[model samples]
Target: MRVWILSDLHVDASPWEPPPGERVDLAIVAGDVADGLTRRAIPWLAQHVRPRARHVVYVPGNHDFWGTRLPDELARGRDAAIAADITLLNAGQSRIVEGVRIVGATLWTDYSIGRPKWSQAWGMREAGDRLTGMRDHRRIQTRDRLGSPAPFRPFAALALHVEHRDRIERILSEPHGGPTVVVTHHAPHPRSLPAGEATGPGDAAYASDLSAIMEGEHGPDFWIHGHVHASRDYRVVRTRIIANPRGHDTSHQRRDGSWADERENPSFTPSLVLEI
Candidate 1:
């Protein structure tokens, strides 16, 4: 099948549309079409994207959960997707399409991809603090049983990550008769980062080295992901890992109302397509 792959559209900042008359057998949106408040991402997909593909799969990125409690935002997205006849994957869900087993999850990082030697406890404390300072923690909220909304903190994010990772591992272990594709919002391996980029502890917030999973006997044939603005295509063991993110625009305005250099991702291809 001809599959179109892309992510990190960030439509709230910059809009996108497929080339005129472009179509594919399947379209996989890795995630982060927009923040929760605008609620434009999925709807935009429905109105402008779905008709171009025979099937479309959407995975919610961290930004999709911002501006509301997690469950509420997810519910809204799910409902919209269903109405549009789209498949929305979250919380480690899987679906079979034309003999292709597609597994998807947000796969939040465990904050150790860049610092593998650090103890889990130390990583959680220090790395967790760093991640908590990000906009995800500031904008996305989680609710208590009593319906009180609070920041979706690092601990909670890590717990959800563990759950999703475990599910992926379990699903991949089972036998399947068809090619498997794994989709995640966060980079599944550290190599997903741009080559030549400096590494630091903060890198843990963006990616996790899940090479163990990809190298397993029953691991997926292809893994597509987003979150890191840099686009990449490489192989780990037998799995082909690919990312095509539009990211933010190349330049931004300075105090003088002139554009300054801001190279977010120059390699993004709007027409990226892979045959599987």
Candidate 2:
């Protein structure tokens, strides 16, 4: 099967379209289609990208849930996806397409990928406070026991990460008849970080060291992910991991008096097709 992969479109910030004449048997939008869950991104994909592929699988990135409430937002996203005939994966859902077993989830990290010393000394709440600058903490909202609105802090995010990780592990361990593919919004291994980038506590917010799962006996044959803006294609143990993100648009002039041209992600090949 020929698969077309892309992510981090952030269409709300800038417009995007698939390369002309690019079509595939399956298309994977790893995540971060837009900032609003039920807004521009999903609708744009349905209208513009869905018809180009025979099958489409979408994973919701952190930005997709921005300006929305948790759990409820996920439900609404799922509903919208179903209405558009697109497959949306969340909470460790698996689907078998054309003899390929594909399992997907957001795979939120537990803030331990970089193993920062401060994180070990401080609690998750303190760590979360330190990361208040991240939009995930400030923009995404959830309800407390009394139904009061609260920021989706690191503690809750960690709990969710554990849940998704455990579920993914269980699914990956199960026997499958054909090639297995794992799709996630967050990168699964630290190696997915951009080349030459140093690891730090903040890095944990984007990726987790899930190499154990990839090295396991029943590890997947391929893993597709998007979160890190840099494009990557490499092998860990027996699995080949891939990420293709357009990142934020930088077409505007920068303070440095230089023009940034991220409008067309030079590293991204919209027509690049992977055969599995």
Candidate 3:
């Protein structure tokens, strides 16, 4: 299978569509499909990006579900996936293609990243009101709108990661003789975060726990993730860890001044493609 990987393509940058004449067997989008849960925009973007692949598999990023109820958000995602002919993975969902097994979930976190710190703090509360993308992203309930004016549970940010270990454990437990690919929106290996807070899922603690739990085996043949907005390829246990993210705007950026410019770079472009 000619699998291509990319993630953190925020749809609010502008409505994006797959150009004609592109081709691929599978396209893996780790997360952040939208700037916020635009609801309608998910289907629009999914349908546009779906045809480029024989199969499309995706998970929503933190940015995709900032202030929404998890269940309602997931239901909307399923609808959009159906419209786009894409597979939106939840816990225990598995798809086998050409003998390669693919399974994933929206694994929730428990602040188990290195040193365990809260994603939100006192400053963060007021910060959103000042900054456009940085803090507003946390409070955004949907595209063109903000989430509740009242504060949310601080743990909510890390809560989604809670169930991930179990789902991933199950996926790793499967005895597929052929190649197995694990996809996650959070960084699977800490090293994938080239530079950042160096504390959460993008750091060493989570990866260490992940590697230890799936004992007796080093790891899967292939693993891909996106969260910290870095392009990395290395080994953790026996797995080939790949983190290739076409991220949204932030303080740091690789190329291009805006998401529009980033979108113009085709999926097959060297910056976006991760063939396997």
* RMSD in order of candidates: 2.9, 2.8, 6.5
- Model 2: per-residue Cα lDDT at residue 75: 83
Give the C-alpha miss distance for residue 175 in model 3, angstroms.
1.4
Winner by TM-score between candidate 2 and candidate 1 = 2
lDDT of each: 0.83, 0.83, 0.58
Worst 10 residues of 1 by lDDT: 119-128
Q: After superposition, how far is residue 187 of candidate 1 from its true place, in Å?
A: 0.7
Q: What is the TM-score of each candidate against the true structure?
A: 0.90, 0.91, 0.72
After superposition, the stretches of candidate 2 with alpha carbons farther than 4 Å from their true spots are 116-127, 130-132, 145-148, 195-198, 252-265
- When summed lDDT is taken over every stretch of 10 residues in candidate 3, the lowest stretch is 200-209
Candidate of highest TM-score = 2
Model 1, position 139: C-alpha lDDT score: 77
Any runs in candidate 1 off by more than 4 Å, and if so which?
Answer: 116-132, 145-147, 195-198, 250-263
205-244 per-residue lDDT for model 2 (tens digits): 7787888898889889999999898888999999999988
In angstroms, the error of model 1 at 228 is 0.6
Q: Which residue pairs overlap in candidate 1's backbone?
A: none
Model 1: lDDT to the true structure: 0.83
Shift in Å, residue 267, candidate 1: 0.6
